[model samples]
Target: MPIKTPSELFIHDLSDTYSAEKQMTRSLPRLARAATDPQLAQAFEDHLEETRAQVERIEEIAEALGLKLKRIKCEGMAGLVEETLSMVDQVQEGPVLDAALIGSAQKAEHYEIASYTSLILMAMKLGYAPAVPLLQATLAEEQATDKRLGAMAEASAIEQAEATS
Candidate 1:
């Protein structure tokens, strides 16, 4: 995993993102169940589906490249998910929990956004023509998910959590 070229970097990033998305697919259900807000729960559920599709898209990229998709353990995502899980167990289940969920989920999205942005640049630099669009599509979804979470936090989750406290 010596990053000597842009292509090498791109593949490394692809593996990292693949691992992160896989982890999200598994962890999102817990987030959905912990959410007090029905809309928030639904959002997590919907994102779980989206994460699965993202995984497929990454697999397709690997297939096209004639490379086996190898997953590098994404320690960053693991830490974020672990913190969120801890919050779920320690916090009271209510709007506060919902707000914390949104915060944690947003952190995840931001990590994804940064990761994909770098990957897209590396792909383009390496003349990875097919991967550019696939990575872009995932990046756009991550950005949209972040925006949705922000809207939920602004419109309800945060305010409700504050009111409860």
Candidate 2:
């Protein structure tokens, strides 16, 4: 459907994010398995649960707003997940790979952060008061995940990778 109004645009973006969250649910397990660092592996596992909840939150918003989320593929997230998974093949399975995974995960987190931020703003502007809290909750989770990943990278992953080099 052609987006001729702000509400339509909001739905488009929301649907895109829904697709992104679904993609992550599938990709995160691989990431968790590939992570050599215990903390990193656990982080991926934890985020997988969060991503599941986030998907449900989006669905709740859709139901509350009486909008059906489009079954569109979010190409942006597809590319991000592809790149993230490819890191396993590109790098050796160790500290270097762990570091690479952090990088990849952060890229996805940043994408989600931006997407959620825009969605929140759109929700507010479109008078989607019901969606604001749900979007904000997901946004908070994404931001926290990014921060945890960054801390892990700084505290160990990057340093370990460098030590191996």
Prediction RMSDs, each to the true structure: 1.0, 0.6
Q: Write the per-residue lDDT of candidate 1 for residues 1-165, one digit (tens) a residue.
A: 477866676777789889999999989999999999999999999999999999999999888876666658999999999999999999999999999999999999999999999988887887778888999999999999999999999999888999999
Highest lDDT among the candidates is held by which one? 2
Cα lDDT listed for each candidate: 0.92, 0.95
lDDT of 2 by residue, 78-141 (tens): 9999988788988999999999999999999999999999999999988899999999999999
TM-score on alpha carbons, each prediction: 0.96, 0.99
Residue 164, candidate 2: alpha-carbon lDDT:
98
Name model 2 segments beyond 4 Å from true.
none
Which lDDT value does model 2 have at 61? Answer: 99
> Residue 122: error of model 2 in Å?
0.7
